[model samples]
Target chain A: EAAVTQSPRNKVTVTGGNVTLSCRQTNSHNYMYWYRQDTGHGLRLIHYSYGAGNLQIGDVPDGYKATRTTQEDFFLLLELASPSQTSLYFCASSDWGVFYEQYFGPGTRLTVL
Target chain B: GQQVQQSPASLVLQEGENAELQCNFSSTATRLQWFYQHPGGRLVSLFYNPSGTKHTGRLTSTTVTNERRGSLHISSSQTTDSGTYFCAIGSAQGTGSKLSFGKGAKLTVSP
Candidate 1:
């Protein structure tokens, strides 16, 4: 079965801290994405990668940076975490063109206090 | 601009009853995906149909791409089916392939 795994299921960080969220996909999909979900707002894309070494900005990418280290791994970095960045973050993978169903990870709930 | 909007915000259903959720998009989408986020917070992909109709088990998804709308229907819903249903899609592929999502429809089932 295709699976997307995210690390540190939950975390609490102080303001001005640096936080990094990691994700790995066994699906070997060409596309990987990071999104944050908050109350009243649906999941919004932060950054996405087409493959290793490629990154694309989304609607909201102000305080986030992402790196695609390998086909199986993607990372989201918060250089200076803030209270507003506290939310549930999900990592998803999909192969474009012929594939459309996106596989999402369990998600990481980060609280920046 | 708001790209996608889901209807009912939330719904409560009785076991064995049917449920319908709506997703409307503002931009032209190349494709659309329907996801079921279980109460526990794990996401399960339900459908990936850009247009027309498709079904799996007790769920049916129909997307009128031309009209920029999609509908998901659940038949004989069960208590385990309770969760938030999300609709996400992209305007196109490549650099601008990021999916814009709807707020989601939260469903609660009572036995």
Candidate 2:
């Protein structure tokens, strides 16, 4: 089975605080994505990386930043956290070949106060 | 903007019953996928049907590319099947890997 894991499964930060959510995948997939899930909104992509050192802006990337330091690791950064950023964040990884079946992490529940 | 819409926002079923979920997209999609999200848990890919029909276990997914729509059928539902089902559409343009997900259809299977 594909393995994707995220760190700080739950976090609480104040407004303007710095927050970083970590994700690592062992499936050797080239594509990694970060998404936020809110009530009635399903899942909204915030950022994605095709490979190490690559980053692509997603549909909702205004208040978030992401980095891909290695093939196995991806990070989502919130430099100035706000209450509105409070949501459940998920990290997923998939390969290019085939249908690009994505495997997701357990997700991080972030609360910005 | 490309949009994916799912019908019957919510569904309730009993054990041994069947369930059908629908998904429609506004634009042409290069890929269509079905995902299951457990309450307070992660999202798991159930099917990656870009076109035609595919089945795994008791789950069957049919995607008609020409119509830009897809359907997922669950046979003999179980309580463990209760969760949110999401359909995502991917375009050929740009990265071709980015997916636009629908609001999802929440399913509740009772014993």
Candidate 3:
């Protein structure tokens, strides 16, 4: 099983506040993804990376920027957080692109007031 | 954009009963996956059946790429199985790892 971890399991920030969510995987997976889950929206991809320093835009990329500093680390930055950004964010990693199963973190619940 | 649709927005089943969930995709899915989400919010991969059929324990998943449809069957449901089931299809638009997810089927099992 792949071990994926996230920081600050829960977060609260005011509108316009800057927030960053971190994710790390120990399986040396080459693919990493960030997603947000809303009641009716399910899980929407925000960004993804296949390697360190590489980034790919997903279906829902607006207001979100991501960086893969290392093969084991990925970060999502919200420079100007809004109440709409409040969601349960999940980070996942896979050894291969779409061929393999992706392991997910416990999730981070962000609340923007 | 790829679209994944899951049916039975919500389901209720008693212990020992059988349950079935469906997933239909808008385009050809080279990678289809089923996930079970714990009430606490962790996602556990249940199956990765892009084609054909795969089974593990009390769960079975069947996917027909040509039809762009898939189904998940669970037997002997338990209270612990109460949560949400999500069906996600990988999109080839980008790195091929990007997935389009359906809203999910909320299942509640009672003892």
Best by the DockQ measure:
3
TM-score of 1: 0.94
Q: Please write out the lDDT profile of model 3 over residues B1-111, one tens digit for every residue.
A: 788899999999999999999999999877899999999888899998878999999999999989999999999999999999999998666555688899999999999
Among all windows of 10 consecutive residues in model 1 chain B, the one with the lowest summed lDDT is B90-99
DockQ of predictions, in order shown: 0.60, 0.58, 0.77
lDDT of 1 at B32: 88
How large is the interface RMSD of each prediction?
2.3, 2.3, 1.3
- Residues A39-99 of candidate 3 have per-residue lDDT tens digits of 9989999999999999999889999999999999999999999999999999999977778
* Cα-based TM-score, every candidate: 0.94, 0.95, 0.97
lDDT of 1 at B91: 66
- If the candidates were sorted by their lDDT against the true structure, best first, what order would they fall in? 3, 2, 1
Q: Write the per-residue lDDT of candidate 2 for residues B1-111, one digit (tens) a residue.
A: 779999989999989899999999998888898999988667889998889999999999999999989999999999999999999887744653687899999999989
Q: Candidate 1, after superposition: displacement of residue B10 in Å?
A: 1.3
Residue-pair clash count for candidate 1 = 0
Interface RMSD of 3: 1.3
DockQ of candidate model 3 = 0.77
Candidate 1 off by > 4 Å: A97-99, B93-96
How good is the docking of model 2, by CAPRI class?
medium
lDDT of 3 at A5: 97
lDDT (0 to 1) per candidate: 0.88, 0.91, 0.93
Clashing pairs in 2: none
